[model samples]
Every structure is written in C-alpha cells, then in structure tokens.
Target chain A: MTDRLPHPLRSDALDNRERILDAARALFATEGLNVPMREIARHAGVGPATLYRRFPTKQMLATEAFADEMRACHVLVEEGLAEPDPWRGFCLVIEKTCELHARSRGFTEAFMSTFPEAMDFAAERAYALRSIAELANRAKDAGHLRPDFVLDDLILMLMANRGIHTISKTARVAASRRFAALVIQAFRASPQHSPLPPVARLSPAAPGKVM
Target chain B: MTDRLPHPLRSDALDNRERILDAARALFATEGLNVPMREIARHAGVGPATLYRRFPTKQMLATEAFADEMRACHVLVEEGLAEPDPWRGFCLVIEKTCELHARSRGFTEAFMSTFPEAMDFAAERAYALRSIAELANRAKDAGHLRPDFVLDDLILMLMANRGIHTISKTARVAASRRFAALVIQAFRASPQHSPLPPVARLSPAAPGKVM
Candidate 1:
C-alpha cells in the first residue's frame, strides 16, 4: 500500500495530519472541545481543506484527541491494581486520575459526556471502573476500606470533584487533591489518617458558591 | 402609607403585585430563574405591562423570587443550631439544607451566583454560615465531628451536591439526601454510626456519565 503512493507527498500529508492532531489536543486541553475547527487548522499551520481531509468532523477530532487520555486512565487503573497494598492502590488511582482530569477541561467533559461515536472510549471507561471495583473489594477484605462503601460512592466522589471551580489551573489541581484526600478519609475503615491537604480557597464561580 | 394611596385603585394594584410574585415563585421553583417575564405574566393572568411595572428587570424578579428560599435556609440553620445535640444538629443542617437546595434549581443558582442588588439575601447567607460555624465548633467539642473538619468542607459538600444531575426532580432529591448521608458518615468521629441510606441510582447525564 505504501509503495503505491508517491513517497514525498505521502510523508507531507502524514506530517500535516500529525500537526492537526497535536494542535487539537493542546487547544482542547486548555479551552475545551468547543474550540473552532478553523482555529485548530490555523494553529496547526494547515489549510482548512487539509484539516478536513484528515478529520471530517469535530466529533472525529474529539474522538482522536481524547484517545490518549483514555489510554492514560486505563494505565493508571492497571497500575493501582498491580500494587500490593490494595487500599493504597485504590487511593492512587482516584488521586492521580482526578488530578489528570482537573488539568484538562476537554478531557473532563469528554470522559463524562455520552457520545455514541466514542464507543471505544466508553469501553475503556467501563474497563477502568470494573478494575477499580475489584480493587475496592480487595481493599475491603484488607480491612482498610469501609465495608459499606459502594461503587456509586466513587461515582459520587467524581461528580463532586467535577463541581470544583477555581480561578486557575494550579488552584483547580490543588482543590482536586484536597477533595480526593477528604474522600479517601471518608472511605477509610478506621478513623486514623494523615492530616488533610491544605484548603484550596474556592473562589466564587457558577453553579457552586462559597457564599 | 395606606392613606396616601387612592382607594379602589390602590387595592387592585396591590392584588396584582401579589399575584405576580406568587406566579414568579411557582415558576422559578419549577422552571428555574430563566422563565420569561411575559410567560410569568401570562401564568399570573396579567399583562406584560403589569409584570414590567412590578419588576423592571430579571434580577429584580430573581431577587424577589428567591427571597423565600433564603428565609427558609436561614430558618433551617437556626433550627439546627437550636438542637440540643450539637453533632445531631450539625447533621440535621447538612441533610435538610442540601434537600432544600436540591428541590429548587432557581434557588440553587440564586444561592451560588453573586448578586450585587441582593444585599439582604447575602446578609442572610452570611448569618447562616456564621451560625453553622458555631455549631461546627460545638460538634467538635461534643467529640462527634472530626476535629479536622473545616467550614470549607461544608462549602465543598454543597458545591458537590450542586453537580448532581438526574432525569427527574425526585431523583435529584434522592441523590442529594444519599450524598448528605455519606458526607455525614465521613465526617463522623467514629465508625459506629448506623448504616447509610441506600444509593439513589445515578442516571446517565452530561458532564458526569455513569457507566
């Protein structure tokens, strides 16, 4: 198949496609998935036609842009499962994955939004949840996790973490870490635990206000 | 003031104003604060002119619409503070206040969103927080609440509760109650508390999908 194409032309097309994907990822991370396609083309230094030739729609771009995050989430869950201490591993996945989500507005929305076109990503999410559920069971058996905790409790934590709004990315990451720690404490079978992370001052924002 | 007004005209005008307020409260409670002014007028069986004469702007209407909710919240906090058992009082505030917020979307937004014209509402909110803070101190001294708990955690809980989205209002209320219970459990000084309320199944929703 490669021999059927002109080498230089094929290589240039591939390079442009890579540039488009890279630009989409960067823009989506900071500005969310709503960034315009034309802007993405300009950021990639590619013509609109060239960009559209590689990716036909915004959904296609989003599906491709978020593939890496889904993989990273999968890797995080797997690493937690591999750990000898089930409870520590469970906490690791929650803390690190939430931090990852906090860093990217687009990935956070994509992870939580329903998209029929993103079946592969959805499968990856389900796999992660299943692995975490197993880890939760192991942690409970170790007498570290509260026996009454349910899978939905983790879901509840994520939903709560999703509400955190801040003035800056650093503040958001800080807030998420503190929230994750609180959740971990809540999930602990015993009351003994380390001191919580410092309070992340929550500035007034939409939907949730400190006032 | 009554003597200064014209006789029959004054009574009719007062009646219209009360009708408009009643309609706004009902609509805002159900459809949120964004219900159209004309729609509110129609719902109240009055003309647009009457609605406009009473409330020149949406913010004024919102301020009027949520005054009751603010009062209710203030009353709930005061009731909690008056409870003899400080820890139980603290739990009561968390459970009932979240239930109140969950019951009305307009009031929820009004509670969180900053409003310069709503100084009275803001003062009420501050008063509630102050009383709750005192109650929290009492809970800590009672040795039921974890000493590490902070006022910001209550803010965090409210914020998280705001993120809950469901297919119906009933589902939202159920989720909020369950979340409040989990939080209270987490905040408890000992693991000797009674079993948690059952999980209110989380429906799939945007910005926080459940697998």
Candidate 2:
C-alpha cells in the first residue's frame, strides 16, 4: 500500500525526489533515453537505493519526467486546433511537432518506441493523432491542403526528419526548421512561389550549369 | 603473385569462384551486408580457406558482387542523359534510383555506409552524382525543374525512404514509390496539378470538415 503512495514523503525525501528528476531530465535531454539510472543517481547526488526507492521503474521515471513535455505537446496541438484557419492550424501542428521532436532525441525515441506500460502517454499520442487528422480534413476542405494527403505521410515526414544528420544540435534544429518549411510547401496545394538553391548530386557526373 | 592473379585460375577454381559469388549475392541480398563470410562459404559448398583465397576481404567481395548493380546504375544515368528533355531525364533518374534502393536493403546500406577499401564504388557514386547534377542544371535551364533544388535533396529522400517501415518488402517498395512521386511532384516547378489522397495524420483528432 505504501509503495504506491502518490506523494507520501518527508521533506528530505521530497528533495531527493526533485534532485533525481532534475538529473534524469538533464541526462535524458543531453544523452538520450539510454543513460544509466545509476549514473543519473550519481549526478543527482543521491544513492542508487534512494533513487530506486523514489522511482520504482525507468518507465515510471520517464513518464513522470516527460510529463511536462507531454503537456507542452498537448498545448501545441490545442493551439493548432484553436487557429481560425484550418490549413495554418495543420501546418502549425506539423512544424511545431517536428521542432519538438527535433529538440529532444530521447522524447523522439520514446514516442516512437512505445512505452507499453505508459498507458497515459499512449492515449495522449492517440488523441493527438486524432486531432491532427481532423485538422488535416479541415485544411483539405478549405482547399489549402491537397486532397490526397494521407496520415502516413506525416509519419513519413517525421521518420525522414529523424534521419537529418548534422554536426551540432543547433545545426540539426536549423536543418529541421528548413525541412519543416519544405514539407509545408510540399503539402500546400499551390505553385512554387520562391526559387531554390543550385542542385547537387550524390553521384559522379558532368558538372551541370551552376549559376 | 597467386593472390594478385585476378581470375588466372583453372576451370574448377573458376567454378568455385562463381559459386562463392552466387552464395554471397543471395545472402547479402536477403540478409543485408552483415552475414558472416563463413556462412557464405558453407552456402557455396566451398571450404572457408577457398572462400578466403578468392576474396581476402569482405569489401572486395561486396565490391565485385555489386558491380553489376552499379553498372545498371550507370546505364540508367546514361539513359537519362540521352534523353533530349533534361527535366524528364532528371525525374527518371530519381524515380529509378529510389526504386533500385528500395528493392535492395543491402545495396541501400552498402551504398550509404561506404565500405572502406571500396574506392572504386565510391568513385562510381561520385560520378553518378555529378551526372545527376548536370541533369539538374539542364532541367532548370529547360524551365521544367525548380531552380532551387539542391543535390542534397536526393540524399534527404534516400535517407527518409530508408525509414519507411512496413510488413513486407513489396509494401515498403510501394510506399517508396508513392513517396518518390510526392517528392518529384514537390520538386516540380509548376503548381499542384493532380489531387492527392486524404491526409493521414500521425496523431488522433476529431473529423474536421471531411468531404
């Protein structure tokens, strides 16, 4: 009964809990989801026993630690839903969601890998997808989004976005932003309004007319 | 001197060599590049020493085995170059190249990973990219391809296409075809011509103005 207390703790226990979470958040953000728990405890200045006593499982800790980010996701989706223009709303959801994923490697991996025990997180993801679907339909009806866009295309974009390899985290985010813009442009039921840069190839060939 | 013979062997040795290559091709095609050389030797009904004698390194084996496919690639690029219409040629190169990659997981990985000692393979890739780049410039000059399309976009597509997870290779190929078409359309200079399928979202949402 005591093991599953929502918040049964003295002052020091509560402090220890906060330190552990802080360490976890820092490590997970910088190093990704695979950071060892013992290392996290060491960083937190807490013993392994103390860390284990507070958070029974890694999944539990991930769920709790990422709760804020999840809430941020919910907020972003809601904001998208609230937009008056459905197409803009759809784009907002995509751009923001991708940016969110790009910023945190751990969260990105977690979201895709499916923490089976994290029912709430799963449910939240499902709900978010449903909302985005509705937004897509609205955008299509508004004639802003192409009629033929499939939901999997978004997943396709995300999976592709995940593959963007750059030198630094900032470079990744910058590249992601550009990728998101390109995706948005691709999705728009419109013509090319702006000129692109010079074409480069992955294979050997005669150099094209480079202007 | 024997090691440097390069096909100076007798009839049975040549037969054994062919069998070894056949085995390597089958295994590499189905199981990716990670399959053990011993397994390949066993499959070929040859002693491991025989296998080692023929091809001292995995890179050499891979380089020789994939030479045909690489030749096909060069032929495809040449065919595109032969076309009077540069834009059509560029699109053909992309579509065909993507299909080729999608069909063979091993080739896809090998091409991207760049095995050390496979200098010839790397040179071919560089040559192909150069040809594609020339095609791109001609296409843009022809007013068919967008001016801003970069060579890296092809890399982006390949990287993204690699992420398409599906139950069957056939399905993955199909999805890849659709994805290629989308990318091609996105790269085209003109406005959206054809209607798309319904938008698919990764997250859940209410049915917004579904038509």
Best by lDDT: 1
Quality of model 1 by C-alpha lDDT: 0.72
Those runs of model 1 whose alpha carbons end farther than 4 Å from true positions after fitting are: A1-56, A116-119, A190-211, B1-54, B116-120, B190-211
Instruction: Return the clash pairs for model 1, or none.
Output: none
- Candidate 2 residue-wise lDDT, A1-211, digit = tens: 2236566688899888888989988787666677889999999999999998888878778777788889889999999999999988998898898778777766665665445343357778877878998999999999898777777677667756755532245655665665666677677776443322222221121111110
TM values, all candidates: 0.74, 0.73
Candidate 1 has a TM-score of 0.74
TM-score of chain B of each: 0.79, 0.81
Query: What's the lDDT for all of these models?
Result: 0.72, 0.70
Q: Taking the true A–B contacts (Cα pairs closer than 8 Å), what share appears in each candidate?
A: 0.24, 0.16
Best by TM-score: 1
